[model samples]
Target: MTPTSSDTTASPDVSGVVPPTVTAFDGNGDVDPDATAAHAQFVVDGGANAVFPLGTNGEFALLTAGERRRVVEAVTDAVDVPVIAGVGAPSTRETVANAEHAASVGVDGVVVVTPYYYPLDEEGAVAHYRSVAAAVDVPVYVYHIPSKTGNELSLETLGRIAALDGVAGLKDSSKDVPWLAQAIDANPDMDFLVGSDSLLFAGLELGCTGLVSAVANVFPELVVDLYDAYAAGDEDEAQRLQSTVFDVRSAMKRGPYMAGVKTALSLRETDFDVGGLRAPLRTMDDAQRAALETDLRELGVL
Candidate 1:
C-alpha cells in the first residue's frame, strides 16, 4: 500500500545555511573521524544552522557503508547543531540501511537522493522513497539531483512522495526553477531546500525555507549571511551576496568537478587538513589552485 504523508512533524530546524560538508580523510586515505567531526564543528561555529555530511560534496558514493556510518557518528557527536546525513545509495535496500544507521546515530534527519544509475518511473521512484521513509523514524528529505542521479522526479511524483509517512522535505538540485516553483506551490506543508549554490537566493525567493549549499562547506559565513539578509528583509544585501556567490561558484568550478571546495579549504589558513579527494577524484592542480586563490583574493574571501 502507498503510504500517504503522515502528520509526522517536520525535523528540527534546518531552515538556514546547511553545509554539505566534505568527508575529511587522513594520509592513509581512510576516514578520519576526528578531522571529519572537526570540520562539522567549524561550519556550525561559522554560523551554519546545520551540517549535512556524506552528500555529493562528501563523496557519499565513494565511501564504504561502514565509513559512512562512522561519519554520521562523528559529526553528530561533534556538534550541537542538527546533522542531516546523506544516506542515498543506488538501491532502495542500501538507502534504507544507511538511513536506519544514520537515525541510530541520532542524525536529525536523512537526505535520500533518488536511486541512481538506472532509470526509474514515477511509481518506482515513489516506492523507493516510501520504503526509505518507512524504514527509519527520523525525517526523510528527498534529494533531487538529476544531474548526477540520472533520475528526475516529476512534480506529480514528488507530490506522491511528499505524502509518504515520515517524508519531511526535499532538496532540489535539478536547477529547474519552473519545476521547483511548481513543487513548492504544490506542497506547501513540506519544506523545500535549494541544493545549488547558484540558486540559493532565488530558491529562498521562491519560498524555499533552507539551502543545502556546497559553497557553505568552505565559506559558511557567505551563505549564512545571504540567508540572514533575506530573513532580515534586506533584499539588496541578499542579492548582492548572491552575485558574489555566482563569482565564487564560477571560481570553484575552475578545476575538475567537485575539487574546488576541498582545494579552497586547504588554501584557507585554517588548521584543517582535509587531505584530498579520494582516488579517481583529483584535486586542483597548482595552476588551477593559483587561479582560484587569485579569484577569491579579488573577492576578499581568501
Candidate 2:
C-alpha cells in the first residue's frame, strides 16, 4: 500500500528509509550518550536516513538494562533522527522493562531479539515478544538472530506477530537473506529488514524496507549509496558498492566483530571507545591490530 497524502506522499514502515546503525561506547566501556550522539550525527551527516543506536555491535548483551536506557536517551536526543534501541534480553520481564524504558525515553521504536538463555519453545518465544509488545505503545520490531541468542524465531512466530497492531516490523540478522525475504514477504504490512550487508545486493531487490547493517557504522556513505542507487534503478552501481561492504563484513568471522569495530573507531582515535570488551573476549594484540589495519587500509576505513 502507498502512503496517504493530505496532498501527501507515501512513506515506509520505519522512520528511516535507509538506517545507518552504529555501536556507541564510552571512555571506560560504559555506555556514553554524548559520544553516541556524536557518532549518530556523523552517520546522519553521511546522508543515512535513520540511525539505530544500540544493536549487537553496541554490545547490548553486556550492557546493563539501565545503561541501555541511557544510550536510548543519548542517541535520540543527539539528533533529530529516529533511534531504534535493542531491548532483547534473557527474560521477558527484563525485556519488557527495557521496552518500557525505551518508550519513556521517546525512541521511535524498540528492536527486541528473540528469547535466549533458555531455548524457549515456540509458544514461550511468542509469549515473550507479546509480553513486551503489550507493555509499550511504540512499534516493536522483532530481532531474529539465532547465532547470538541461540533462540530462533520461526516463520510461524513471525506470522503470529504480524497480525498485532504494535508489532510493526522484523530485523532478521541471521544472515539468511532468502529466509528473511520469505518471512517478510508473507506479511506486507510488517516492515522487514535484513540486518546484514553481505546479501544486500539481493536483499534490497527482494523488498526489504531498510537496512541495519553493522558495516554501515564504519562506512555510512557506502551503505547509503547502495540504497540510493537502488531507488534510482541503478542496480549495477548499487551492487558494486554492496560487494565492497560484503568483503569488509568478513571481519566479523575472522575474529571478534566488536573488537574490530571498536578498533577501527580507536584507530581514528576520535575519542570514541567501546570500553575494552567484556570477559570471554579480550583486547586485540599487535598482530590482530596489524591485520585489521591492513584490511581497513585496503577498504579505506582507516
Candidate 3:
C-alpha cells in the first residue's frame, strides 16, 4: 500500500530500532525500485520501528538526485512505518532541494548530514540546517557523522539547529558517546538516535531515544529487541541482545563497511536480493564471506 500525501505524518515518538537501509541494485548497477521497496518492506515486517532510506548504508553518496528521490518514494510506498530519507548533500541548496523532494515523496522526515569535502564552522553548520529546515515542512534531522563527512556538530551548533522550528531530531554517528551525551544535555527536548549498533546499549544508557544502525539491515529484531528490553526495564535482556548485536556487527566490520551488510542480507536468503555494494565499494570476497559465515553460524544468526 503506497502512502499518499495525506499519509505523510511525522512520527510522534521516533524511538526504537530504525535501519539505515541498504540500496538494492540490478545486475546492470541501476537502482532497482522493486527490490528496494521489497527490502524496505522486509525490514518493516521484521520489526523495524521506521525505515531509513538513502542513509549512509543506502549508498546515498553514490546515487544521483533522481535516484535518491526514487529510493525515498519506493520505501515510503512500501512501508506503513515512518520513512526518514537521508537528504544530505555537498551543498545547502542541494540538501534543501533533496529534502523538499523527499517531502513531496511522502517521507515522514529527512536526515541531513553535515556538508562534506569542505569544513564547516558552527555558523555555517547552523545556517546549513536552518536553510534546510526552512525549505521543508517535514521534520529535519541533523546527521552527525564526522568520520565520513569530515564535519562535526558541536553542542552549541546542535542547540542552534534544535532551535529551528522545522528541526525534529538528531542522528549522532560520531561514535563519541560523551559528545552525544553532551548534545543530549544541550538539547533536552530534541530526539537523538545513535548510528552505531555497537553503542546501542550505551546510547540507551545515555538517554538516547533510538538507534539508526547499519547492522539492523541484517538483524532488525535484535536491535528492536535490545531497545524494547531496555525500554521495558529488562537490563539483563537488553545486555544479552546487545552482546549478540555486537557479535554480528564484529563479523560485518571485518569486511568493507556497507558491503558486509549487503552480503549478510544475501546470506540470510531473503526474498529480495540486496546484491553487491555500488561501485567504489566492492562486495566481500570468498574469504571474507567465509569468515562472516563462520561468525554468523557461531552466533546462529544464519
CA lDDT, every model vs. true structure? 0.90, 0.72, 0.85
Q: How many Å off is the CA of 250 in candidate 2? A: 2.6
Deviation in angstroms for 131 in model 1?
1.1
Best by TM-score: 1
lDDT of 2 by residue, 1-302 (tens): 23322102222345333443454555565666777777777677777777766677767777776777787888888877667778888888889998999889888778888878787787787787778878987778888889988987778877876665577778877987668878867877677777777767676777887877766676777788888888888999998888788777775345664566656656666645445665556567788877877887887755
Among all windows of ten consecutive residues in candidate 2, which has the lowest summed lDDT? 3-12
Clashing pairs in 3: none
On TM-score, the stronger of 2 and 3 is 3
Model 1, range 51-134, lDDT digits (tens) per residue?
Answer: 889999999899999999999999999999888899999898999999999998799889999999999999899999889988
Point out the higher-scoring one by TM-score: 1 or 2: 1
Question: For model 1, where is the 10-residue window of minimal lDDT?
Answer: 1-10
Q: Give the TM-score of candidate 3.
A: 0.95
Q: What's the true lDDT of residue 206 in model 2?
A: 77
Q: Candidate 2: lDDT of 281? A: 61
**TM-score, prediction 1:** 0.97
Question: Which of 1 and 3 is the better model by TM-score?
Answer: 1
By lDDT, the best candidate is: 1
- Residue pairs in candidate 1 whose N, alpha carbon or C atoms collide under 3 angstroms: 4-163, 5-163
RMSD of each: 2.5, 3.5, 3.8
Sorted by TM-score (best first), the order is 1, 3, 2
